[model samples]
Target chain A: MPLEDQLLVERSKKGDREAFEHLVQLYEQKVYTIAYRLMGNHADAADLAQDAFIKIYQALPNFRGDSSFSTWIYHITVNVCRDELRKRQRRPTVSLDDNNSDGNNYTYEIRSTAPGPEEMLDRSETQVMIQQCLDSLNDDYRTILIMREIQELAYEEIAEILGCSLGTVKSRLSRARQALKEKISKQMEPLSPCKRLAK
Target chain B: MRCQDVMELLSPYLDGALATEEREAVRLHVARCPKCSAELEELRACIGMLKELPLIAPPTGFRVGLMEKIDQLPSQQGSSKDKNIFDRVTGIARSSWYRVVAVAAVMAMAVGITSLWEKEGVQFLPLEQKPKGVVAVHEPQKASKEPPVVKEQQPSQVGQSSEPGASGSKSAVNSKGSGVKQPDPQQGNATVPVITEAVKKQVEGYVPKPSTGMAVVSASLRLDVVDIEAALKSVGSIALDNGGTYLGSQDSGSIGIKVPRQSFERVIGALQKLGGVLSYLPTEKDVSVQHQTAKAELERLKAEQGELQTKLTSEPSQELERQLADLNQALLKQIDTMKQLEDRTNHCLINITLQ
Candidate 1:
């Protein structure tokens, strides 16, 4: 941990809100990115990222710093996503037409300085295509892929986070990569078969 | 190897994680086979595309909303047992109904001091057991049943959190995941966390002790209450009085509270009397075997790791390296499981549905 981060963590443990908010400002981007990648939607990404931070705040006292604080927070972000994903699996599927039943029933407040233009710029053809492919994947494949590929977590760390053995992580990550490749191919083949399959 | 065999190793092969022979075999196979080569290429492209996903900002008001949510959270640090007991006594001392008792206790303290000093040889004490003053013994109900004995000198402020088990192990810490100081009486004089026999007996039936397999007990109740809100408040208060936390309504709208294991039945009985009991189910789970197994595994792995460290000093081989890495991962997994087990075995969760 950086000296500043170490100091911030100590102060946060002592219930210093300013120190905690500063800590949040420092990692909000990384934590939000992890949430966005796992959740694949802005609304859920926002909700769950905040949930992750709350969990981080509550679990801060118990943090023995066994792992790097980055790794610790990343693990929390992933776990929050995993739990929500699992709960969604168990939840009854709601129809798209059911407005009230939709998860994001609350109206999004218009920000004076919304990132509409920046988000528009970010949504190039390739980003959307790949995200669509990622969203098409099963929960396990998507989660493992995000952790390994996007978060770039080590296989040992992924294994520890998912509470699986090393062998399981390797095989599952390999399968996830294969699954993602097939999804990407399926998505790309629709746009231009010649370009996709070209040598 | 066949295409299936080659495909299974391609991701790790891309990341340079395969064994040397497997890497070489996959490389040679992909070079020769168009199908395997295309699959490998596609996997590489997919990873590249994933990496291209831009870092997007969170929705507006993310920080403001998060801070607001955090403000509602119970203060974990301030809720230490000492502060809570002090606050409780202070709250009670301020109440009008308790003035007579308070005044009487003040008078009694003035009168008991010389006798108490002579009998107990200057307890060097400010006042209470578990709490920290004369106010604790003023509980007229408890004072009559059990004669007051001076509390043992406290260890450190950090040494106190929850009730200790028979062994005073870290596992004996509360399920709240608070700071658990593993007090060793065998250590120097200052570190003695001596919970006197009398003190242990006082809280024996009420508090959770994380020992004897840490048996967690809980109860679920379905009640026909006249008003849901009142029932919820009553249930929450019951939890508070028993030194537990109310978990509030889950998505299913069931009111939940987590109390100490020993207090599970008492809480259940009290709740049952509140209204017409539609259904009640008490559950108990003993996790001693699981706890013991994880502990043994941790010990064994640590010993093996020590041996490997000694070997690494003499010869640093890849095989030894792999063994050490695997052992560390195993240790991490074991530690996570142990933590979950301790958390579960620490408290009993009661979910009550009001009809």
Candidate 2:
């Protein structure tokens, strides 16, 4: 643990609400980002992030410092997300976006003048397709991929968060990347004609 | 390297998790094999696209919303520790042996209090009266033989002031030196003051400080009521009558009520009158320590905020501005928390469950 975090944890354990609130401020964005990727939606991600912090506050006293505070927090976040997923499975709601075959309409302003509108659209479409593919994977694979590729967490950190060995983390990442590749490739197969014409 | 070998190492190589030798082997093979090289390129493109996915910003007011939720939650110290003690007491109550021990302990306490009250003629005053003083009966010869349990009760006595007379008296000597000497144990007489008048005179030279600790009282009740709505209404009225308000109510026949700490026992008594209580658990948590800790923290933050403000005024840098902003936020949160603790300690919560 960093000396600052250790001090914060000590102060938090001693019922210093400000110390815990500081810890919350420090990790809220990162936690929200991970939750958004895992949950594939903004509202649920925010809910999960709030819940995770509340749980962290309650459980901080018992935090034995066996693992780094970040890892401990990530572990709690993943568990909370998993519990939410399980609950969601019991009473499923149809997502309106699921039927909307049109890609995300949210515009991305390209900073560079190199790419034309058509190329930007294609890239945006591909990005949407990749998200869809990531959503298609099961929670374990998707979580590992998000932690690794997007969040850029180390393998050892991923393993600690996932409660798996380093070898499992490696294999899972490899499998997740392969699965993503397959999905993207399948989505792009129809675009090959458009690609050839664009070329 | 075989094509299959190079293929298995591709992901790790892309991830930079492979050793130098393994990375070199895959590199050399991919350079020689077009199929392996294409696969590696595809893998790299997939990862690159994944990385390019824009980071999602959490909705605005995320921290504010979270802080609100945290504020609504029961403050941390009282709930868990009290729950553990409550659970242990309940557990021990369930076992026969422990129940016997508990009964014995209660009996011993009753006897000790009764004997002391008889000797001192100490009247139990209403909640408003300041504990005048406890008549400390110390026998010099029997001091060494005093039970450790009696010693334990002295601090509680000291914490709660008691006076020497039936009528309220203002004399410090009457309150402080009320300890009477017992000549014989056979007569069951009151004992002498532990400290002699000379010693008390010497001690009187020092200033006396008052106790400022606050106690938080909480109760949880499971009731079998005739009508849930009626019971809830009665509970709400009870709270209102006691200068409290209905904090909230749930559709599931659960209601949260907050009443003044002084009227906590009265509120519980009123609640019991509404229905047959299946379980009534009242706990008093001394959050003086927690309150003091938060006060100290608030003072420290306020000092820091003042220092930061001074620094910002002297050097108008962006870094100082940001730091000041963060410090202000932290200070606000700390003050809010301290205010909440004070409010919570002043009012007791009664979580009533009706069936």
The alpha-carbon lDDT assigned to residue A104 of candidate 1 equals 38
| True contacts reproduced, candidate 1 | 0.51
Docking class of 1: incorrect
Off by over 4 Å in 1: A90-123, A194-199, B79-355
Which runs of model 2 end up more than 4 angstroms from their true locations?
A1-11, A63-68, A87-124, A192-199, B19-21, B78-355
Candidate 1, residue B15: lDDT: 88
All candidates: DockQ: 0.22, 0.19
lDDT of 1 by residue, B1-355 (tens): 9999998899899888999999999999999999999888888877887866666666546887898788665444433221445676676556543564445456556646744774787664445432323443444334323322211111121234343421123222222232224322122211111211211222222222234556667778899988888888899999999989987698443798998876877888899988999999888887777677777776787688668756754554447645665565565456657766777776899999997
Residue pairs with colliding backbones in model 2 are B131-B161, B132-B161, B133-B162, B180-B191, B181-B192
Lowest summed lDDT window (length 10), candidate 1 chain B? B189-198
In candidate 1 the C-alpha lDDT for residue B114 amounts to: 44
**Per-residue lDDT of B24-143 in model 2, one digit per residue for the tens?**
999999998999988888888888888777655555567767777865654354332224556756754575444443443565565557556756866553323422121222322332
